[model samples]
Target: MAIGDWSSRMRGAEPCRPGTEKNKGVAVSPSPARRPSFREVFAVPEFRTLWVSYVLSAVGDRLALVALTLLVYDRSRSPFLAAVTFASGLVPYLVGGMFLSGLADRLPRRSVMVGCDLLRLLLVGAMLIPAVPLAAMIGLLYAVTLLQPPFDAARSASVREALEGERYPLAMAIMGSTTRVVLVAGSAAGGLVVALFSARPALAADAATFAVSALLIRFGVPARKAAASGEDQPSPLGQLTEGIRLVFGDPALRTLVGLGWLAAFYEVPEGIAAPYAGRLGGGAVAVGLLIAASQLGAAISTPLFTKKIGPLTRLTWMGPMAILACAILAVTVLRPNLVASMGIFALSNSFAMYQLAANTAFVERIPNEKRGQAFGLATAGLIVGQGIAFALAGAAAEVVPPSTVVALSGGIGAVIAGGLAIRWRGMSPAVGRHTARHLGREASLTGQTPIHAARSN
Candidate 1:
C-alpha cells in the first residue's frame, strides 16, 4: 500500500463530534475521550515528518557531543580543556532560555528551526578548519549551543500543533522513549565512529545531519504566524519577561513547571555513576550498565504509561511514582551489589512518566503563540537544575560516600514532590485564562480568531 493509504487505514474514519447538553441554558462540556494509540498518533502526516526530523537531529546531537569531546582532548592534550568543551554544550541552555528563546516566539517557528539548523551546520563546518584557533573554535561551538533553546522550543511547539488533543500526551511519551533509545545508541555509535575514523569525519557527518534536518523541517512542516505575544512585546527582553510571568503567575502552570524541577534531582545517581560503580566492586562496564539500566527503565515505562493510565489519573501518578523512586534510591545507602544497584537506578528512572505528564499538562494550558517560550522556559529549568544536581552531588561525594549523596538527593526530591502534589490536586489540563487572554488579544489585533478547539488525533 502507498504510505498515505497506510496512514489513512491506521487512523480509521473521522471521529464523531462529542454530544453536548444544556443545563439551565448553559452548554455542558463533554467528558474527556480516551488517549489515542501510537499507530493512530503516527498517522498524523506532519507529526510523522516532525518525528523523523527530531529523531535524526537528536541522534546526531548526541554523536556530536561524543565526537567533539574526544576532539578537544586529542588536540589540547588537556583534560581541563576537554572537560570545559564538554561543559560548553550544556551552559548555553541558560543563556538561550533567558535571552535567545524569545526568538522562537517572535519569529515564525519553521523559520526559527530552519535557521538554527543552518547556523549549526556552519558552526560545525568551521570546527573542521585546521587553521581555526582553539579559542575561536570553542567560541563557535558556544554560538552553536546558544541556538538550542529556540530550536527546541520550535520543535516542541511544532509537535504540539501536529498531534492534537489526547494524542499530545502520547506523542510526548513516544518522544521521551525515543530520547532514551537514541542516547544509548548514539553514544555507542559515536564512540565507535571516533575510534575508527577520528573526530573529523564524525563532525562532518554531524554537519550533514544538520543540513538534512533543515531541509526536512523547511519542506515538510507548514508555515505558521509568530505569536501575538511576540508582536505585543516591544523587544525580545519584553517577550522573555512576559513568558516568565505567564508561566509563574498562573497557579496551574506554576505547579506543572515545578514538576520538571522536581524530577531533576533524580539525575544525581546517573551523575555519580562512576564513583558509585567503583564502590560496588565493578569497573567501567559496571558504570555503563548502571547508566543503561536507568534509561532502559524509562524506555520500558513510557509506552505503558498512556496504555494503562487515564489522562487525569496519569497526572496524579506523577507524585506517587516520584515518591516511590526516591524511597528506593534512599534505600541504596545499604550499599547494594552491582545487580541491586542497577535495579535501584532503573526503579528511579521508571518514574520518568512524571516528566511526560508534566509536559502534556503544560502544553495543554499554553496558547499556540506562547508555547515556544513556555517550553523554552521549562526546558531551561530542567537543564540547569540537572547540571547543578550533578555538580553538587559530585562535590558532596568528596565529603561523603557516593551512595550517601545519592540517598540525600533522593530524600530531597521526595520532599519537593510531596509538597507539589498538594498543589497539583487542583490543576487541570484544560486551557486556562492566560491562554484565553492570548487568543483574545490575538483576535483583536489580527482581526481574525485563530484559536480553535483542540481535536483528537
Candidate 2:
C-alpha cells in the first residue's frame, strides 16, 4: 500500500500521493490462537532489533528522569526546582520541533534514528562527568531533545511500514502499550537505582542504554525507502509550515491533533497533583506513590482499551472523565491519607489509556509521509498544552485549595471531553465503526483465557 498523502508531503520537497478519508474499522476478531503472540511478532528480525533497541532506550529514559529529579532535589533542596528541571526537559521538544522536525521526512529514517541514539548517548554520558556545569548540562539535554523529531518520525513510520497490513494496527497498539508499561516499570526501577547508588550511576546506565540502542539499530533494522517530499521545495521554515498545513488539512487529522491537546489538558491535574498532595502533607514517598499509582492504571488498562475501542473511538472524553473520577476520589479524603490518595491518583492513569487510543487512531488515519512531523507536531502540542495545564494547576493551588482545584478541573474536563468525543463521533462515522471493532475484539478476547482462538472465518 502507498503511504498516505499527508505522509508523503512531510518527506521534503516532493508532492505526495493523496489519501482518502476511508474508514477502515478494526475487524471484530483478531486472528485466532493461530495468530502470533506479541512476543512472536517481534521475533521477525527487524522487529527483534527495534524492540531490543527501544525497550532498552525506554529503561534508560526512565533512569535519566530519575537521575535528573534526584540531582535537582539534592542541589536545590527544593521539590519545586526538581519539578522545574523536569519540566524544562519538555521545552526543547516544543521549540526545536518547529524548525528541525522536517529532517525526519528529508533523511533516511535509519540514519536519522541512529544519530538520535548516538546524540542521546553523548548527552547522557556527559551527565556522568561531574565537572559539567548546570548550564552545560541543560544545554546538552536541550540539544538532545532537538534531534529527536526525525528519529521519532523514522521509528514511527518504520513501525507502520515494518508490519504493513492487518498487523499494522496491532503493531501500533503493541508499541504504544509497551512504551506506557516500560515508563511505569522504569520509574520504579530508576528510583531504586538512584537509591542504591546515586544520580551519576543512574545517568551512566542511561548512556549505556542509548549506546546499545544505537548498536541495535545500526546492525539490525532492515533498510526501506520512504516517500520523499520534492527536492526543490521551500526553506526549512517553509517545510515546517507545509507539515502544519498537511496535518490540519484533513478532518481526521484535525481531530487527532485535538486529542493530543486534550491529553495535555487533563493531564495537568496529575502533573501538579502530587505537589498538591505534598502541600496537603503527603510526604515524599506518598507523593511518589500517588503519581506511580495513577500511571499504573494507564499501563494496565490502555492496551485492553485499544483492543476494545477501534478507530472511530476517541479518548478525549476519557482524559477528563478519569481526571474527574480521580478528583472525586481525591476529594473524599477531606484530610486524605496516603493510601486513599494513592488510589485516587491511580485512577488518573486512565488518561494514559485515552492517549493510547488517540495515538492509535492517529497512526491509522494520518497519511504516512507526514507521520514524523505530524508526530512531532503532536508532541509539540502536548508540550504546549501540558505547559498550560501545569501553570493553571499551579495557580489553582495558590488561589483555591488543592483538592478543590483538582476536583474542579476534573469536573470541567469531564464535561468538555465527553462532549468532544460525542461531537467527534457524530462528525466522523469511521471513528465510530473503528472504535466498535476495536472494542468488540477486546471484549471477546478478554474473557477467553487468551491462548484461545479468535481468528476470522
User: Highest lDDT among the candidates is held by which one?
Assistant: 1
lDDT of 2 by residue, 50-152 (tens): 7677788878878887777778788768878677667664777777667666666676778778888988888878777867766566666667667765666
lDDT per residue, candidate 1, 307-357, as tens digits? 667654566576677676666689778878889888888988887667776
Best-matching candidate per TM-score = 1
RMSD for all candidates, in order, please.
8.3, 7.5
Clashes of each: 0, 26
Model 1: runs farther than 4 Å from truth?
1-34, 229-231, 426-457
Candidate models: Cα lDDT each: 0.72, 0.61
- What lDDT is reached at residue 10 by model 2? 17
Residue 357 accuracy (lDDT) in model 2 = 48
lDDT: worst 10-residue window of model 1: 1-10
- TM-scores for all predictions: 0.85, 0.79
